[model samples]
Target: MNAVIRTVRADEWEQVRELRLAALRDPVAHLAFLETVDAALACSDDFWRERAAGAAETGDGQVRQFVAEGPDGRWLGTVTALVERPSAEVRFGESAKVDQTHLVGVYVRPEARGGAVVEALFRAAVDWSWTVEGIRRVRLYVHEENARAAAFYRRFGFAPSGERVPVPGGVGAYEDEYELLPSASRDAVTG
Candidate 1:
């Protein structure tokens, strides 16, 4: 079945929480995410509320979460875009030297893996990222061990910027940064 992609609603914190928990339970939760489910579960409801609100459609455009909903109202996949500014304080890896979007929290249920869901979700995110003023490019970092994700990003027209950051406490593991210039077309992922 096809999935419908859209920005998350502010009041849907429960759904947000559930989706995150599910992602955390995936077999690849370790390689795909930086946080464990235990840490996520420990967060207060207020924390989740703020998290959902901060990325909701009606919130300030700093961060936005895109979710793919199945026909039965279940979330199948999600990806979030965080606005990074040249002078703003850095959140992860190196400081942002340009106005760009940071893609994170990428997740797709195992059952929904080999379909159009990921592309649809990313399309929503990239489209939104370009609409943000000063967004010269969109970028994301993939764990070096996650070849599937790295290949997908390459197919998405995101090429390595030759920058790598060590994975905190990962013992030789690193995150590879990839970027897509805004001037590229939506059909250019295969480039």
Candidate 2:
């Protein structure tokens, strides 16, 4: 499908909220996302607006949200890149040991699955990560049962970092960290 991938704008909060709600309602959301549809739906419009503005293209470079817009102007997918410094508070997973970017809120419409749309979104997120000053690598967390997502991340050149963190509110569930780096370098770090 022909889709344009770009950073989200501050004024696109409504679209961002809608797309997030749709993602949370997906069948695999229980494993793919840390939040519930009901919880997301309960958030106020002001909360969404703040979230969108923080990730907007004109906002600080620490965070960015990329969207895949179809030719008809509909949003097909979205991915967020969050820059984590070594000293920053841990939001999800372990605290950053080095400067890096964490990919989150990845979602693609069901109709856009098995196509290049999701790939394009990932490419945009990872490509943007390298542009950030001091960013050493790009990483993301995938639930252990999320085989499809794990496979896709591996195909995209991310290797398991051997780090596991308990999934919040999920008893006995854990998410594994995956990092993108050159093969030679990946082995040294992930090994």
Candidate 3:
């Protein structure tokens, strides 16, 4: 598979919205994503446009969205990373103890799995995170029941931190948080 992993441009909001909706429709979306396709589709164009702009190069440096584009320019996957300042209140949980990056909205088309598309996307996101000043780690959450995702995250050097977030409801609906400290080493490519 020939694909290029790059940051999205502000003008590509429509594509961003489309890819997100596509991701939501995937079978594993319920386990990996927090939003539904219907909810995403209902979002006004202005919302998507603003989101795209915020993640683009021209926007603030605190957040970034990366995509894997096929040789034909079709989007195969995407992931977003947001930089968390030490003093900033965490968006999803408690206050951040260290400057870090939160990895979220990870997805890849089923047809594109095992083609290094995800690895490329991670490389781009993690590399960008490392470039941010004061960043000490990069973290993400995965549904506990999604063993495939947990294994993939472990393969990428992330480990469970023992800190869990309730799935906004109860015990039966929670996801486990996993983190990768800046000191951890990552293989540039995995077979």
Candidate 4:
């Protein structure tokens, strides 16, 4: 609960990669993330370095990554937000519906799950989103079966937009999209 929550540094790519791989190994990783542990582990060092650089504070408004680090200097969790431009097509769903921030790569170490680490990460991500000039809302998708994640999102004030993205290959799966509009009162919704 005493962890420091802040934006990631460009030089901390190895830390980013380490925390992400730990998240992938979580029991709920199947429901919470798209990438497998093997895939994450196989990524080149350059890939992680570039990713960290892109999400660093110095990267400007394009992308942002936030982290919660314990007093011991170990990273307990991380969340990344990507700024979706109006001129560009959205990555996962139907093309640009709005210029927004797509929240992704959310994770918390199991030992840190209930200690407010996730909430702190969300605060950082949402704060970053609000700083963007034209962002209308901050949105994220969760696997339909991820009740814990859904409950956390709801508790944090995200609402299902009633939009669903089918899992590719027709595996009879879907991910639900949730959003928190910038016009909404953040305190009223998330408290």
- lDDT by residue (1-191, candidate 4, tens digit) is 78999998999999999999999999888888878999998999999999999889888668999999999999999999998977986677545578899999999988898768888889889987998988888889999999989998888888999899986657799999999886552762332
CA-lDDT, candidates in order: 0.89, 0.89, 0.86, 0.86
- Write candidate 1's Cα lDDT for 1-191 as tens digits: 47789999999899999999999999988888888999999999999999999999888999999999999999999999999998999877887878999999999999999778888888889989999999988989898899999988877778898888988775788998889896664656521
Which runs in model 4 stand beyond 4 Å of their true positions?
188-191
C-alpha TM-score for every candidate:
0.96, 0.94, 0.94, 0.94
Q: Candidate 2, which segments miss by more than 4 Å at Cα?
A: 182-191
Pick out the ten consecutive residues of candidate 3 with the lowest summed lDDT. Answer: 182-191
Q: Write the per-residue lDDT of candidate 3 for residues 74-166, one digit (tens) a residue.
A: 999999999887678778754578888999999999889976888788888988999989888898989888999898888887888888887
Compose the digit string of candidate 2's lDDT tens values, residues 50-163: 899999988888899999999999999999999999999998998999899999999999999888888888888887888888888889999999999998888777889999
After best superposition, candidate 4 residue 61: deviation in angstroms?
2.2
Residue 41 C-alpha lDDT in model 2: 91
Determine the backbone clash count of candidate 3. 0
What's the distance in Å from true for residue 176, model 2? 0.6
Model 1 residue 116 lDDT score? 84
